[model samples]
Target: DQIFSSALTAALMVGLAALLCGAVLYPVVVHLSADNEQKAREVLDSHISMMEALGRAIAKRDSDTGAHNYRVAWIAAGIAEKMGIEGNTMQALIAGSFLHDVGKIGIPDAILLKPGKLDDTEMAIMRTHVDQGKDIVIGAGWLDGAQDVVAGHHEKWNGSGYPARLQGEAIALSARIFAVADVFDALCSKRPYKEPMSFEASMAILEKDTGSHFDPGVMAVFKPMARAIYDQLADCDEEATRKLLQDRVKHHFEQ
Candidate 1:
């Protein structure tokens, strides 16, 4: 009886220990998972914040539309996805659409802010921004995905564009998408040199240039979203727009 009692007690102790471990382990595991999720959320927020700061910086660089960059990036990514470009292509769309005109950082204030039309000499200087943009993207460590867009975005579907003057398939796919995004933003955005053209007029312009200025497949995608995208652009405040242009231009030349 004594021997049997001792054996039963040992068995009871072992079972109780196992139950304690199971109970304690679960809360620890749950706590760790919750901490990990919080950390991930913070990291995601940081990346978005950085991108917004970059958008503001780029606005300072060219004195053009800064938020317009963000809006176009969103629109172009949506259109690119619909057209069957996936994965890294979508990422490139985001990066390229945001930094497509980064080379304008190198342009002189004269051409960038001229109140009138660019003469031939000014236009030539203006075009140099394409090559300058290519160099900037290549040199910058953070903008690895943006170089192709900066360099090739100006290239035409019909081989009439600057820099490499690449035509059709020779141009990077992101650039092709950017051609539509950039033109749409430019036509719709109020600029120092030109008033914002009405949407009806802009559509007429885009339609006329179709195969010559933009990729056919990309245009097919942009057509349906054009109205919606303009609405997004319209949400921007003009005072903020003017301040961004004025401040950014002043800062760039000061540097």
Candidate 2:
């Protein structure tokens, strides 16, 4: 009888010790998890800020207000979400969209800001921006993932684009997805050289290009959302557009 009582006390003592340990460790574990999450968020924000700063620098060099980068990124994110792209690929798409034209920083102002059509020589120099952009991103460890769109955004579905001329699925999917967003934003946004094309007219042009200049599947996904995206972002000021894009970036990167 005494042995059984001692065994019961020992078992109760062990259980009580376990409960004490858990009671002490639970808050510590929660604190560590929360700390790690905050650290991760800070890292993501820093990366995003770096991307935005680089994008703005390129935009300023090209005589833009930086709305162009924000708009394209936002538009690309929308299309990617609709197409069921998420996680890292989605993050890369957003980064690439913002920094796609970053190579333009290397172009001569004479060619980059040309008021008229680029002569063949000037055009060739302009085309080199893709390579310049590729080099820039490849050298930056944080931005290496953006290389796909940076290098291939100019590539066409047909084998006609410059720098690489990657055709069809040979073009990275992120690049293909961004191609539509870039051109659509350019068409719908006014430039010093031309008026903004109407949404209907822009869609008409995109439809005309179809499989030749864009991925058919990507185009199809973008078609339905084009109107709403255009309406929301086409005329937004820099502040409004940046805020909208920030929300998207946060959603993608934080998740």
Candidate 3:
């Protein structure tokens, strides 16, 4: 009876000690977790700011108003959401859309800003922007997720694209989705080379290229949403578009 009592008492003492230790450490652990989460948020915000700065630099170099980046990012994110793409994939699509033309920074102004169609040689040189963009984003760890759209946006659905000529599902989904958004925006937006085409004309072109220049699946999802998206963004100025895109970035990345 004496031995049993001692063993029972020892077990109770050990249990009490463990409970005390947990009580003492729980608050510290909770504090550390909260601190870590805040630091992570700060790091993410800094990275996003850096991405915006690089996008602005590319726009300045290309003589663009930078509205294209904001518009495309907004449009792509919308389409992605409709297609049920969420989480990190959606975030990558947004980032890639903003930086898709970043490689134009490396192109000569003669080619990038030419008022007329590029000749064969100039076109060849211009296409190198895709590779240049890939190299630029590949070096940054935070920007790594963007490499897919950067490297593969120019690729077509039928294997007629540049650089790699990737076909069908072989191309990154983000790139495919961005291609649809990019072409739609370019057609509807005014440029030095030509006046903006009407929404009808733009959709017509996108429809015609369904399986040739664009992914059929992505186009199908975007077709219904195109008119609303264009109408909403068409009249908005750069500031408005920027604010809209910032809200989207926050939704996908910070929230």
- The lDDT for every candidate, in the order shown, is 0.74, 0.90, 0.92
Tell me the TM-score of model 1: 0.72
Q: What's model 1's lDDT at 211?
A: 92
TM-score of each: 0.72, 0.93, 0.92
Choose the strongest candidate by lDDT.
Answer: 3
Cα lDDT tens digits for candidate 1, 1-255: 999999999999999999999899989989999998888767645644554566666689666657667656666676776787765556556766776777777788888878788999999999997887677667444456677787887899999998788999899888888888778877877776679888889889988998998888889888998897687558667455434433432332222
Stretches of candidate 2 off by over 4 Å are 1-13
Residues 132-154, candidate 2: write the lDDT tens digits: 99988886866888999999989
lDDT (0-100) at residue 104 of candidate 2? 92
lDDT of 2 at 33: 100
Model 2's lDDT to the true fold? 0.90
